[model samples]
Each structure stands twice: as C-alpha cells, then as structure tokens.
Target chain A: MAQMADKGETFPATVENRGGTGRIVLCCEHASNHFPAGWGDLGLSAEQRLAHIAWDPGALALSRRLSASLKAPLVHAPVSRLIYDLNRPPFSAGAMPARSEIHDVPGNATISAQERAARMRAIYLPFHTALHDLLAERMALGLDPVLVTVHSFTPLYFGKRREVEFGVIHDDDPSLARAIVKAAASTGLRTGLNEPYSAGDGVTHTLKLQATPYGLPHAMLEIRNDLIHDDQSVARMAELLTPVLNMGLAEIQRQAKAS
Target chain B: MAQMADKGETFPATVENRGGTGRIVLCCEHASNHFPAGWGDLGLSAEQRLAHIAWDPGALALSRRLSASLKAPLVHAPVSRLIYDLNRPPFSAGAMPARSEIHDVPGNATISAQERAARMRAIYLPFHTALHDLLAERMALGLDPVLVTVHSFTPLYFGKRREVEFGVIHDDDPSLARAIVKAAASTGLRTGLNEPYSAGDGVTHTLKLQATPYGLPHAMLEIRNDLIHDDQSVARMAELLTPVLNMGLAEIQRQAKAS
Candidate 1:
C-alpha cells in the first residue's frame, strides 16, 4: 500500500490513470529501468546495466506520451527489468534471465522457490492485477477498452542490424494489426509484419493471456529502440502513432457496434 | 499492506493455504459462497444462495483437501461468484453475471469503468499475483512445480444432470490429462473427457494461461459437485488424486529431463 515512489523508487512497476473518456486502455509491460535496492546492480557495470538487457529503454517515455496524447489510461510495471521481466511468463527461461548475451546474472541463478514467489508476488502480480482491474472497470462501465501495448525493440540483436522501422505483431487479432500497418504505411513509415519477434512465439504474455482472451482490439506496437532513445524521437514516434492508433480504434469500434 | 481478512468483515473473500513444501501450486478461481455483502441474502432465501450461482459450493473444500494432502499451495478468490467471476476474462461479458438460473445478481447492473477496474484490481489481481509469485519462486529454486487446478461442476447445467464422476481437462498437455484419466479409471472412477467444460472453451484460465506458458504439467480436475460436498468426501477425493498427480509429476520431470 506504500507508494513505490515515496520510497524514492524511480517508477512503479504498475501505474494506472484515466487518460480520457475514450474506450482505449494503454499498457507498457516493460516500462521501467530501476531495480530494487539490494539486488546489487545485477552484477554488471553501469553501462552494461543500461543496455537492452536491463530494460526496454524507450518504451516508458513513448507510453507516457501516448497516454497523454490519446487520453487513454496507461498502466505500466515499475521494477527494473533485471529484477523480473514482467512481459515474460514467470517460468520462461528468459523470465529470470540466467544469462543475457555475454553477461551472467549472478543474482538470478539458483533462486530459492520462496524468493521466486516473493518477487512474482511483489512485481509481476501487482502490475498485471492492476491492468486486469483497470480493463475490467472499463468493461463494467459499458465501455470496451482497446488494449494497446507499447514496447521498444533493440535495433539489433546479437550483432546483426535490423531494418524494420516499425512492426505490428499479433497472433489472432490480425485485423487491428493490419489496420495499424496500413495506416502507418500511408504515412511513409515502413512497417514490419512480426519482425523482431513473432506472436506465434510462446514467449508472449499481456497480449495472449490478457487481451486475446477478452477479444479486445489489441496490438503490440514495437518501435526501434534507437528511434526512442531520446525524448524528441519518442515524441516524434508518438506523433506518428497517434493517428494510426486512432484509426485502428475507430475501425474496431465501428465493427463492434455493427456486430 | 494490511491483511484483507483483518478488516473485520472477512473482506468478502477468503485465502486458503493448502500446506505443502510450496513445490506445487493449486488454484480454484470460482471458490467462494458469497453474494454481495448487502443484498440481504441475495433477494432469495438461504436455500437460493446455496445454489451453484452463489459459489462453486464443493470446490473450496476439495481444493483445501488437495492442497493439504499434496503439500501444495492453494489460492482461492473469496468474492461471491455473482460479483465477478475470476475465471472469466476482465473484458468478457461473462465476468458480470446478469442472471443465473433462478436468481439474478441485483448489484451487478450498470457498473462504471472505474468501479469495474477497482474490483478486478482488488480481487482477481491479488489471487493471480500470488499464484504467479509462487510459480516464479519454485522455478528460481530450480524446482519445476506442477500446477493443479481443482474445481467442481453441478450434476447439471442450464437444466441437464451430468453423469460423469470426474473430468480431467487440458489444452495442449494431453499427456497429463490422459495419465490422470488412466489413473482414475484404474481406481474404477468414471471420468469424462473435458466434461463440464472444454479446453477450447476460451473461458478456462489456469491451464491456458499459467500451465501452458510454464510448460509445467497441469490438469483441471473436475469432480461432480455432489461427489465432494464435505470434508470426508474431499479427503477421499484427495486420496484418489495423490497417486495420479505424483505419477503425472514424475512423468513430466522425466520428460522434461529427456528433452
């Protein structure tokens, strides 16, 4: 019940606020970069800690901007990615990240069962529980909230340079993805279809487990990490994305109403 | 921060700890016999509240017994089924019951977005967050805890009497379901295939979200409501399930190691 920020924390793993009267609910699963005290910098140098492994650097900023512009409620996880990756299922090999690239996570290995549960209860559950509650509240009000997950993908994985400017990945709700892609292309930004990661990959959470189940109009919007590393770039991306998202949301609403 | 039950009114929900080494976790999403704190006995006499609409009457008892016998942790949501079904997705219409058999949920009509999110955040999130944390902790300790979800079904639904004595349901993990069926049949109990519900129903949560993602062995064991209505019957059901679950866990471990 203590405000995480009051403890001098950087960002709460989960935060929810009404954006506007619109029926869209925004979520950023990997939104923070601060680890709790005592994890001891994840056994990495400061520079290494700031790398993609620690957090999705630009996502939180973009999500904040989107939340402000779209006037939709935004919910995000606050703990550092190093503590526990909220996006990954708790059991995935990547969830605890025994190893990331060349860095070995000393604190993550051989964690006690109690410790694992503690972290999950502390971080993962609160974030998701908040999101679920927010969505449920929206629905109970006779409003269907379109789920928009904001994320940033590193421009490169391993050592290869990627070329996707933007990507829309989805498993079952291709309609929303298609609309976003088409809307973005109309604006001259090249979009990738499931580039960086595929929804088919079993490694997804929020979307598959939460969104798809409710048949909510949802999309996993992946912006190149390089493009969102700074505030200006993040703003630019959000600017371009606002209309696309609006278009998609409107279309989905039209379909829902017609049906 | 504060204990929910200590609030004096039982928080209208309950949390049950089925004692175990915390190696295996069990959950019953629909495990309460409640009707909003105010409905003055829910517009029906005491007999009506006792119906399946108010709670999965037989589930909590069986879940408690299973958790105790197997030394597994059990997490049950303590709200009335009529308030918000935890098993149903937050955005799904099924979440707020409009009508159930003979009685209607009077307090559930015309809820607002904020109120809906509050209920979801308050109840559903806490229950799942605990489960997620438990599983994460076990994995961190290098122990793959199997998740067993327990529930009970009425002998009839919408007006038909069910005939099966037991049901083992799974989405992609047929091996565990098959093993349980074989184990149960070996003891001469008549088991049904995905009876009462189907893995494909899109509403069942435990198996699809938790079990499937963790790649942990799981089975949704459904016993007829009448079959396990009391402690003695719950204990007997647990006695019959222990060997089957042990076998399933062993097979899962062996297969996990082999792969």
Candidate 2:
C-alpha cells in the first residue's frame, strides 16, 4: 500500500515507514495543498490556494518531527482538503464545501452527486481504509496504539483573531487530550481544550471514525498556522512539541498501569 | 425532483405533495428497507432483511399519516438505510454498514471505494439533495418550517429491553425537543429525551447537518417499533403524535415570541 506514492497511483494518501511497528501512529491529514490533476485550481486564485483554506502550512513539518521523535509510523493525506477534506465526514456540506471563509469554491459549488461520489472513491475511502488497516494490524498483534492526527488553523477567522495557540481536539474520548493539554501547559504554551473546534464542528472525523469505535486513545492536535509558517519556525515548533507529546503519552501509560 | 417517484426514475426516494405550502416539513430518512438492485440483500437472510435492522417497520406509514394530518410535505428515502444511510454523513461506517446489530453485513463488509461512490451518486446524494432542495425552496418563500423526522427503534437491543416508548432527539438545539417532551408528559406515554440514541450515537446527522445549519427548529421522533408494528397501532400512534407535535410547535412559537 505504501506504493501509493507512485506518481500514477490514484490513492490520495501516503504512508511513511509503512512497516514501522510503533505504539503511536502520527498522521498529518492536511499535510499538503497539492491540487489534483483534473480539478483545476478549485476555482480559486493562486493566492487563495496558498491560504489556510487549502492546507495547514506547517502541519507536515511538525508531523515529520514528531514521527522521528516518537519513532512512530506517519501517514499523510497529500491532497488539499479543499478537494477532499480528510477530516470531514463524506457527503457532508463541508466535505466538498462550496465556500470556505470568504472565498467560494466554484468547482465544488454545483457538482452532481455522481461527481462527488467519484472524488470519494478516488480519494477518501482509500485514504481512511489505509489508516484503518494499519491500526488494525497493530491491534491484531495485541498492541495498544495511540493515534494523534496533526492539523493547523488560521490565527484569524472571518474577521476575529483566534487566541488559542495549541488546540487539543478530541471526540467522545477525552483522556488522551486531557493528558496532552496538561503536559503542554507545563511547557509554557497557550493551549485550549476543545477550543477553536471540537467534534461538534464537523472536525474529529478521523478520530471518531477510526479511533473511538476501536476504543483506542486518540486526540487531534491543531497548531496555529502562523506558528509554523516557515522552515525554521516549523522545526522550532516541532522541537517544543515532540517532547511534550512523548511526556503526555508516558503519563497516559502510567495512569493506565496504575488503574 | 417531485418526479423522483416516477416508475422510470432510478432515484429511490419519494416525495408527497412536494409543493405543499405548510409551515412544517416532514422527512422520513429511513422510510423503506427495500434492498437495492445490485447490492443484493446486503448479505442478510430473508428474515433479517424483513426485520428491524432493515428499516423501522412502522415509520413510513406513520409519516404518511402525519404528512396528511399536518398538511405538510413529506419526503422519504425508499431504499434501505443499509444502502447509504441517508441519515448518516456518507463515509461513516454506518452509512454503508458492514454490520447491523448482531448480524454482520457480509455484502458491505468488503466493497471498493469506487463501488461505494457509485452507490452514493445513484442513491445517497440525490435523496438528500431532494430533501435539501425542498426545504430550501420553502425558506426561499420566507416560510418558517419546523421539521420532525420520523423513525422507530427496536424495543430490544443486545438482549436488553429499552423501556422508553418514544425518543425525542436533537443536536445542539434543545428548544424543540424540550417542547415535545413537555407536551408528551400529558399523554401518559414513556418518552426519553435523547433516549435509545442521541447526537453522540451519530444518529442526528439530518438534524445537525440539514436542520441545525439553517437554524430550523427540528426534532427526531423515535418510537418503539413494537408499539406501532401493525396498521391499527400505526394509526393510533399517529393519532397520539400528530396533535402532540402541533402542541409542541405552538409551544415553541409561544416561547420564541415571549423571548
């Protein structure tokens, strides 16, 4: 399945260290803003495509650092969420949104049902199935795997500026998020528990669909895009985050053992 | 779209009095459990297909009666919820369930992303789009609609008997559910607020996606299937619910005006 990286392959997601046997599986769901071949520009100008509406600019770099730091396997969706939002439940109005922020997605505004289905078949289900199978294999080996999907958000939305820097998002299970938020506070970062977004905001699809059903401890990490906009900043942000995440996981495992 | 019911049409949803100018719109997302043409029986035994897992047995008939009683347009998905689950955001595991209750859906257990997309194009999206369009038209006409989606639950699940005869479910908005619960108190029937299922059960997609976004006052009614299993019982259930719903709506309007 890792051969999915070949240029001709239609599967929209990619896996790094596909055979890595690790306890924490890190995924950068909005890792890239690469527009697919046929869907030209999604009816957006070049400037708009480069905006937060396309992908989380620094999420991939942070995920790479965490993957290395935690020695965990990393999975990524390289396509722009604008084409197929990996985080949204399929066929949702937000799935192929006609509008994001102030810009209208003209390509998505009036697609026929058949066309939307084609996008899902080509991009969505496979990406999720890959991650699902990866986690299943680990669970089959009697391993307790923890999942953390990486994302980033704009500092300002609509017109208001958002204050939360590190957003710890979760679905029904908030154990992992609780641990992460506690550890981050010790590291002197502004963190919000379920701030900016939660499972209610049509976010947390990956965790809800893939992790909660299996009873796996999972959480979503949302970084402010401004924090990791450049290479050096991304590396610095990663340096601050990698150890915090490791500490959080250790705390969770310790609590689990004590219980 | 009203012609969606014509014999030659491939779409499996039906609309009743699609042009009705009433202030309430009724939708039965799981009105039928008829298996689709190619997805044969979803690997279920004949008995299983005829059972509660296939569809809410008494829901459609009750919806029909309510549509008439309220003089509101009624819309339904004639294909089984098992096909694409019009009520679920597509891509959800339950949307094209590989399992229902204790029975495994062998046919759905393994399907290509391409095939899932085809099902969505042919059946899923059209059905929702039809309903969306119906409600949108009413809104365009400056009509304030209160929505009530009808469904039924098995009296027993996983060998446990569920005592609540009626469940009033909602998303973030609790105004309508609150009103319905208050009105039902006088009827001397067991009613649970968000019982049997809730927004957490992934059961509130229609309300959350369709109703909540538009600020429409909506509630999902889940009756115990056994209570309305037969024709006389179905009529009786409608007789009991129709006025109660009207009363609830009046209460909501009254409450809104008071505020």
Candidate 3:
C-alpha cells in the first residue's frame, strides 16, 4: 500500500492482493480507526475513539485473511468511520454522523456544507472511485467478479447483546447471499440471512451503489466483533468462511452455467 | 414552464418568471402533492396523500406571489414529497420517507438500489439541474442573486402545537436569515430565527447543496400551514412578506457596499 504523506493522512484507500485472480472483489469500508492529522479526535475520548464506533475492530485483519485465503483483491478505507462512513453516500447525515448509537460526536455536529463537500472530495470520492476503477478493470479483463464486503459489528449495541454470529446481508439481489447461506448451513456458525442488520437499516449502501448498477452478484458479510477479536480468532474465522465463500461461488457459477 | 407528460409525470421541475430581472431566486421544493402514475399514493389513503406529508400546503401559491411581487424566478418540484423530497439529498431516508409523522409509507419501505437511483434520475436530478443551470445563467449575467427557498410546515407536529408562524432558517452563514428576521420585526408575524426547524434538523439541504458552494447568500423561509391554508391567505402572506424580503435584500446589499 502506498501512503501519500502530503495529504495529512495515510492512503485514502488501499488495495491488497491487486493481482489476485479470484472471481471475488472484496471491500472493507471500516478498516481503520485513524482520525488523520487535522480532525482532532472528533471530540471523542481516546477510549471512545478506539471503540467499535471508530472502526470495526479486527475487520481489516479478517478481511486481509480472507483476501489471502480467497485469492481476491481487497480495497479498504484508511480512516475512521467517524471521519466519513464509507458505506454511507455523500450528503447523508450518517456520512458524517453527529451521533452514533449511544455516543455524541461533538465535532461532527456543526459541519458546514463546504466542509462536508470537502470531506467527500478528500475521502469518500477517492475511495469509491478507486474501487469503481478496479471493478471496471476486472470487467475489462473478463473476470466478472462477485462483490463481497466484509464488516464487523459490536456484540453489545446500546447495552443489548446480539446472539447472531454471522450475517449475510443483501440489498436487492440475494442470489449470492442465498448461496452463501446455503453453503454456510453445513458449518456450526450461527448464520442469518439479512439478519443483525438488513438493507432496511441502510447498511447495504456499498452493495447497492457499486454492485447493483452492474448486475454483479453481491453480499455484505457482517461478523459479530466478539467472534474475531484476536489474530488467531480472525484467522480461524477466515478459515471457516473461506471454504463457504468458495462453495457459494462454485454453486452460483454452476447455476449460471445451467441457466 | 414545460411539461414532459410523455415521461408519465408533469414537468419534473417548473421554472416561473424565467425572464424576471430581480436579484433574488426563489425555490419551492414541496410545490406539488402529485403522485406520478406508477407510484400509487405510496400506499397512503387519499386523505393522507392530500395532507401536508405529501407536500407543503400553499407553499407554491405563496412562492408564485413572491415570484411576481419580487419579479424573481422560481424553480419548483412537480411531484409529491412522497416520490422524492427535493429538499433532501438523494439516498437520505427523508428523500423517499418510509414514514412521515403518523403515516407509514408502505411503498417506500423496501426500495431497491436501482429504484432509488431511478427516482433520483427522474426527479431529484432534473430539479437540481434546472435550478443549477438557472443560477449559473444568472451568475453569467452578472446578477449575484440571493437564494430564498419557501416551505410551509404543519402547525401541529407530532401532536405538539408550534407557535412560530415564520422561521428564517440558515445552515452556516446566517447573514440572510438574520436580515430577514430583522426586516420581519415590524410585521405582526410570529417569526423566529431558525425556529420550528433549524439546520440541525436537516431542513436546509437546498441552501447547503445549491447555494453554499457558490458563496450565494441563502435562507429558507418557513411559514406555518395554518396561516396560508387558502389562496387569499397565501396571497396576503406573500404581500406581507414581500416588503420584508425586499428590505432584507436591501440591508444585505447595503452591508455589502459598506464592507
């Protein structure tokens, strides 16, 4: 990954396994908890900044393991979701949320329109544009890749505990998600289809914006953060998911060929 | 004004007083309660469709009077807010609200990504483009026009009575809003600065998105629906506010010259 030191931040977004020949294109939108130089913690305490609200803990690690296991290209954001939630479109309040869950983000409360646009220019646009270009390049190379985004959610949300371990969420098209669910049925992991969070929760924006337009099969994988807290657990989760993703891909390909 | 009946709706956005010479550009975003042919009432009853939830009552009439009174151009959305709230940026939940106040919009609950983009293309884009082109043309003609968006709110919100009849709301720059409040002081109108709804309420999206980038003086004028329920009242309200608006514009210009 190349870092632009002059931009006051690391790489806006980074690509790993760029030459991977797998039929899957991976995205990890909440990869980093970095606040950059000028943003100044977003009026958040150090603990709060490091909390799940800043970034998905271990999500980048899990995504990296998956990228290696699936031999897929991975694109990830390099700043905190507090800076700009990459999944949310520009101008949506959630894009630069003033509040998230139980915590108040004082820094985001009074952003000017010009500043909003500037954040989009510096962060959101570059990341999405890079992913779009990669997708286009893959299409040009006749890869016909399936889009799969990796994310992690906190086990306790607003003091409530979540029992679901894995979620396969879809926006409109559920082909890949269904296939993954079917493939995951053999495993002991408690997987739910459109569960924990659904498209109705506006979590599938990445799938909707990037994949639906191109008719690419897409799904968002949300792992409960407790399951992948450590490097070993992340690797184990990747090991468990890798084969299921492969089988899902195989099943979809088989169906496509049959049709 | 032009109508594209072939597209199964009226004019996506209508512009009045296109050749007006005033240095103010007025916008009525919630100008219509029209649900296009395909979107059947958004699963709302006839009464609910006609209610303020669908569109701001009497806002267009007041805007038209102001357009004539000030000899300023007016650009307005021609579809119900149920289809797409022109004031909200695309992808926002409020753009195609699943619920407004006590009403649940069954039709908008599970929109596909393609459908969302389609609505943006059909409604939001055309409206904004028309307004943007108008502003660009005005700038080209050396008229540094002020933007004034007209809207009307229900007197009762969520069963709570709102006493403020007029709200001069701003996003960041409060110059125009402050000026309007100052000018409205002489009138008997119950005016409030950023009252009823403020920038924090996400009510100033039009001003933020359309005007802020160009450094245009902008403010949103919100009138209580009870005061402008009839055409006569709308005309009278327009008459009362017309001079206030003129005085506000004069004050801003005078301040500008003094600076």
Query: Who wins the lDDT comparison?
Result: 3
Ten-residue region with minimum lDDT total, candidate 3 chain A = A1-10
lDDT of 3 by residue, B105-150 (tens): 8888877655665566678767876786577556534478789999
Give the poorly placed runs of model 1, Cα more than 4 Å off. Answer: A1-11, A14-19, A35-37, A77-79, A96-99, A102-122, A200-203, A257-259, B1-13, B102-123, B156-159, B200-203, B229-232
For candidate 2, the per-residue lDDT at A72 reads: 84
Scoring each candidate complex against the real one, what DockQ results? Answer: 0.40, 0.03, 0.02
Fnat for candidate 1 (0 to 1): 0.54
A53-155 per-residue lDDT for model 2 (tens digits): 9989889988887787778889999688888787775546677788999888887887665555556655766677677656755653446778999999999
Among all windows of ten consecutive residues in candidate 1 chain A, which has the lowest summed lDDT? A1-10
Q: Compose the digit string of candidate 3's lDDT tens values, residues A1-259.
A: 0112244332458999988989999999999998876676888999999899999998999999999999999999989998888897664788888999999998898776656655666677668767865774564344687899999999999999999999999977898999999999888889999989998888887786667645689999999998999988998999899999999999889989999
Return the number of clashes found in candidate 1.
17
The candidate scoring highest on TM-score is: 1
Residue A202 displacement (Å), model 1: 5.5
Q: Which candidate gets the maximum DockQ versus the true structure?
A: 1
Clashing pairs for predicted structure model 3, backbone only: none
Clashing pairs in 2: none
Predicted structure 3, TM vs. truth: 0.52
